[model samples]
Every structure is written in C-alpha cells, then in structure tokens.
Target: MQPQFQSMQTTGSIAVGQNRVLRNTYLMLAVSMVPTLIGALVGIQMRFSFFAGSPLVSFLVFMGVAWGFMWGIEKNKNSGLGVALLLGFTFFMGLMLSRVLQVALGFSNGGSIIAMAAGGTAATFFVLSSIAATTKRDFSGMSSFLTVGAIVLLLAIVANIFLQIPGLYLAISAGIALLSAAWMLYDIQNIVRGGETNYVSASLSVYLNLYNLFVSLINLLMALTGQRE
Candidate 1:
C-alpha cells in the first residue's frame, strides 16, 4: 500500500512537469512569431532576394544556414540560448518567406487569398493541437512515415527546381501542407506524452511545422484561387 501511494505521487509529479513544459513551449512559440513577422516585413521592404543568382546555389546556401541554426538550437536546448537560436531561425525563415509573399501579393486579390491561407493554417493548427491534447491515441508511430514522406518531398522539390513543372509544383505544395499538419500533430502529442521535455526544442519543432504549413497553404491557395491583374 505504501509503495502504491508513492507510485501515484510520482505519476502526479511527472504530469505536473509535463504540463509546465507544454505551457512554456506555447509561450515561447507565441513570442517567436514576433521576430518572424518583423523579419518578413523587413525583407519585403528591402526587396530581399535569396535566389537573385543561381537558384540551386541559393537553395544550397539556405539549407546550409538553416541546418546550422537548427543544430545550434538542439545543442543548447536546455539553456536560454536555445530559445534565442530558435527565434533567430524563425526570423531567417521569415526572410525566406518574403519571396513567396511578394509573389502572392502580385495577384489582384492577393490580400484576400493571403488572409484565407492564414485563416486556414490557424484553423488547422487549432484542430490538430486540440486533438493532440485530448486524444488518447498514440501518435508515436507517425515519425518514421513522416520522415520518409518528407525526404521524398525534398527530392521532388530539387527536381522541380530544374524541371519547372507546374503540376509538380502544385503537388509539392499539397504534400507540404499535408505533411506539416501531420508533423504538427505528432510533435504536440510528443510533448503531451512526455516524450519531449525541453520546451525550447519542442517549440522549435512546432514552429517549423506551423511555418511550413502556412507557406504551403499560401502556395496552394494562390495557385487555386489567385486572381491576376
């Protein structure tokens, strides 16, 4: 009876810690968005073009920088530096985003389309996060499948850069949207299930999921509903 009581107390304490981690992750995620918006606005204002030269070279450089940031964040996941790195990475991502936003804003009804995409992404995040928090089903099995899908998608993207196939572009956009949603669900659930204890790392994962989801949704909406001048 005494050992059973101790086990129950241990379980409760673990639950409390997990809840704290989840709450902190949400807080950090919200804070990170400010820098992202600022970066995007600044890039748009300056007419920044990462791909001003060769697209392939630009892409390789971007990947190298992005991966370096992610590595830094992971390495410092237990410290304040991790949060800072995550925010910085998001800002870089936002700068990358300006290219798409510039293209999106080119359409006559671009503002409305952008709003719709944002709304859709928000709704999707709400739904997925709610399910992740409330559902008892295990999402652990999704990691491997999502990883494989992402690799295939990455290869497709590189191929399309040279192939320049419109249909494949649309397909990739759709794939990204779907994959991001699934990854978000899996990540949130990992936190909820106590598999992810570091708020910084968890926030970085979730932030990327949201960022990609928003970008992919914007691309899909533009391709499907954009009105040109």
Candidate 2:
C-alpha cells in the first residue's frame, strides 16, 4: 500500500492545485459511494458472493480482481477510465461486503449495530480529517507506523483463516479499525498539505481506508451488541 501511494506522480509546490484536487477527490469519493451502496443493497437481496467454504480461495480471487482494477485505474488516471474503474471497484467491494452484511442483519439488534458503526465511522473521519487540515505538524511520520500496523493486521487476518480463533478475530478487527483511522488521517493530511496531488489516486486511498474502517466497526459492533434470536 505504501509503495502504491508513493508510485503516484507528484506535482511540485502547488498548494492551491492540491487543495482543488483534494476537494474534487472528496466529491468524487462521495459520488463514487452511490454505486457502492446500490451494489451492497442488491447483493443483500441476491446473496451474491464469489466464494464460500474457502477463505483462501475467496481472498485470492478478491485480491486478483481488485488489484487488477487498481492497476488499470492507476494507468489511466489522466482519463475518464480511472473514474469508471474506481466506481466499478467500489461496486465489487460492496458486493463482497454482502456476506458480512447478511450475517450482521441476522442479529436481533443488527440494524442498530449497523447504524452505530456508520455513525462511529463518520465521526472518526470528521475528527481526524479536521485535525489533519488544521494542524501544521506533519502526520507524514504516521505513514510508516500505520503501514506497519496495517501489515500486522493483514497478517493476523490471514493467519486466522487457519486458526479460526474468535479472540484473534476480535483483536484483528480492533487493530484494523485503529489502523484505518490512522490511515484516513494520514491520507487526508497529505491532501491538505499537497503531498498528494492526484485526485483519482487520493480518492482511491481514502475510500479503501473508509471501507476498512466501516467494516471493522460493523464487525465489532455486531459482536458486542448483536442479540441473536
């Protein structure tokens, strides 16, 4: 992920341009969400999934498709193709989320848990983003820490596919939520300070962070507040 971020071309000394890019990126991010929600809603009704009973298979499939789309987007960010690919990727992610959404909606308090998680995610984003824009202190330093944290969280999640431990899942979820929050801050701060100039790439990075945070929070809330009937 860190390498992917660094791979973007940087324009020098244009805070105004960066700000415009950031603003447009956010607008695109907001607009990009529509397809995602639609996809998730349809997925819930259709119960669509790429795999079952094989986490490894599912993981590999998802990675392959997602990375392929990401590569294409990066290659074509200067064209309309990037926006199309980004939205397409979001829809794919939304479809992927249905499995968790299905399990979550099964709990008696599922809807409440989902709402709370959404609220929490929104609040976290607002607060972190505000600090990122206002503070003169650099959060670029957090990149390394957040990257390391994310790698560990990813490894733990992969390990759990075999271990199948509840405790491990909880820990990974918590770590991911934290890392996602950190990532959001880092990405947003970079945007504000002009470290990130490509609106398409910026939107993609922040969108992924938001998606991870939302999923992690939803999982945590379901475990803690869900009431099985």
lDDT of each: 0.93, 0.87
Q: How close to the true structure is residue 184 of candidate 1, measured as C-alpha lDDT?
A: 96
Instruction: List CA RMSD, all candidates.
Output: 0.8, 6.8
What is candidate 1's lDDT per residue for 1-229, written digit by digit as tens?
9999999999999999999999999999899999899889988998988999988999899999999999999999988888888989989988998888999999998888889888998899899999999998999999999999999999999999899999999999999999999999999999998999999999999999999999998899899999999
How would you encode candidate 2's per-residue C-alpha lDDT over 57-143 as one tens digit per residue? 788778899999999989989889999999999998889888788888899888888888889988998899889889888889887
List candidate 2 stretches off by more than 4 Å: 1-13
- Candidate 2 scores a C-alpha RMSD against the true structure in Å of 6.8
Model 1 TM-score? 0.98
| Leading candidate by lDDT | 1
